[model samples]
Target: MTFPKRFSNLPEYAFPRLRRLLDCHGPGGAPLRMSIGEPQHAFPPWVAGIIAEHAQEFGKYPPNDGTPELLSAISDWIARRYRVIVEPDSRISVLNGTREGLFNAALALCPEEKAGHRPVVLTPNPFYQVYSVAALAVAADPVYVPATAETGFLPDYGALAPDLLDRVAIAYLCSPSNPQGAVADKGYWADLLRLAEKHDFQVFADECYSEVYRDDPPAGALEVADEIGADPERVLVFHSLSKRSNLPGLRSGFCAGGPQSMSRIRQLRAYAGAPMPLPLQRVAEKVWADEAHVEENRRLYRRKYEIADEILGDVPGYRPPEAGFFLWLPVEDGEAAALETWRMTGVRVLPGAYLSREVAGENPGKGYIRVAMVAPEQELRHGLTRLRGCLFG
Candidate 1:
């Protein structure tokens, strides 16, 4: 049997590689997991009642785009959150999760070639793994840009050469970035929009962690695009209920952009996308409309943020995340630190190098570890304390 050559160079996924590295060794102390970003917070109690009410819809095929009610709810939430008005019917497409939408949108919007050459997709080093895979799936050259501490944990796409920029088809940006937890401000968004307009490339803004923050809500891509009057299609923003409402299992997300881009995305989805089940869509409709539960969820995360700061503040190179739940704690070497931390304290963490690509013989994340703060407050405090004593002490 033969497999496609496109994915031949792909590295083993982050988690499996982690299991292989740590599972064979016996943990030296009580086991405490802080690896995956799966939220352990409680979702709204009403979620079950809503799902039960819509259980009958399971027998019917879900709408390929989304149910009218769900779309409107999502649109209304956008209006409330980003202050941008989006027509639910033409400007938004519901996704099983942002990951699926992120991958499929590239298939729909990326051209076969740009400037008569193989297209380029820009992704930040230490980025979510899906971005590179999406670029490869579309046969675009994936250019991994460094988003290290020197760059404020955000990729500087504007620094690319004109020739490289001209051939770019899409740039994947995650505000409130995963691992590092850096939020892009208004100026950052505006500058990026201007650059996109000049280069004629689409911006894929992964804003899944938007709702979890330390201070003011982070500026959004669509909000900035509207302020600068950039092409509506120039920015496609993806949001998820996973972090926002502690509903990772719900797999509810949406992508919103200009009509042309959305039309292409929706058309592609109609043919090959997996629509959210009607029962789940019904649940999502209600979830999007409610912010009380989301507010409570953020409150819990804020407490955890305080705990992390208190525990790790004195450690060298400790940067408290501006937003989001992960702490990108610096270490001498990621893989070695992870193994030692697990062996000494049984507090599991992800090696940062696994999240990044090697460029110029250097992996930017090689000197760090990513610690998820999603466990309960006290449990998370215990893990952080163990991590500090074991690694930084």
Candidate 2:
């Protein structure tokens, strides 16, 4: 039997590749995992109580778009976070998780072809794997652009040829970027918004890490999009409670965009998407309305940030990220550093190259490792100290 060719060219997904590379090896000391970005902070204590209180609703089908209460909560959070008002009915759609929305948006909106040719979807190197897969799922050409130290660890979309731009249907951008922790500033957002306007492409902003930061909160794409008077449908921003609210298991997130685009997305979701359970949506509504838990979560991450800075600060090429819980550290070779750390200290971190694809003979993440700061403070300290002693010592 023949399989689809689209799936043929893609490399194995990151975790499977990591297991192949590391599962054979045994930890040399007490094991400490800093590889994946799963949060370890305490999720809100009230979550279980809330879910139990509303459990009866589980027997009924959930609202396909969102319940009024859930939509209102999401809209309120957007206003509080970005200072931009989004109408519950028109601007917001509850997602199973941001990844679902991010991938499906491409299918629901991308045309079969663009500019009389195959469409292109631009994504940053070291990107969340979903971006490239979404491009391929839609049969569009996925273009990986380098987002390395030389580029402030962010891709330069403006450098692509005009002809390429003309064929671009969408561009996926992650601020407080995954693995890299590079936050795009307001100016960066503005420039990208302008480029999208000029070239006629949509921007998908993955902001799941917006709440985890070192200092001032990271600037958001919607704010900048509004500031520039860009077309409302030109940008769709995805946010998740997974990192921000320490509730990954809840699988709640949202997508906000212009009325027409969101309508199309909602229509597609109506046919293929699973709505958040009614009870879960109730809990999420309350979670979104409250900031106290989020503040506490951020405080926990901040301490870990300081500990990492103190431990790894003096090392060459160590720059703390402005936002997000991962540290992207420079090394001579990412895979070598990862293996060495795992072999010597039992500290497992992801090689940055695994998070990125090679483009133009250079993998943007070829010489770095991504350490998740999502573990407990003491655990993080141990992992960092182990990592420092094993890899940099």
lDDT of 2 by residue, 1-393 (tens): 989999898888877877787779998788888898888899899999999999999999999898999999989888888999889999999999899999999998898999999999999998999999999999999999888788998999999999999999999999989888889999999999899888889999999999999899999998888878889899999998999998999999999999999999999999999988999999999999999999999899889889999999999989988889999999999998888888888888888889988877888787999998888888889889989988788
The local distance difference test score of model 1 is 0.95
Query: How does model 2 fare in lDDT?
Result: 0.91
Q: Candidate 1 on 261-302: residue-level lDDT in tens?
A: 999999999899998999899889999999999899889999
Q: What is the C-alpha RMSD of each candidate to the true structure, in Å?
A: 0.7, 0.9
Which ten-residue region of model 2 has the weakest summed lDDT? 14-23
Tell how far residue 381 is off in model 1, in angstroms: 0.7
Off by over 4 Å in 2: none
Best by TM-score: 1
Span of ten consecutive residues with least summed lDDT in model 1: 190-199
Error of 1 at 54 (Å): 1.3
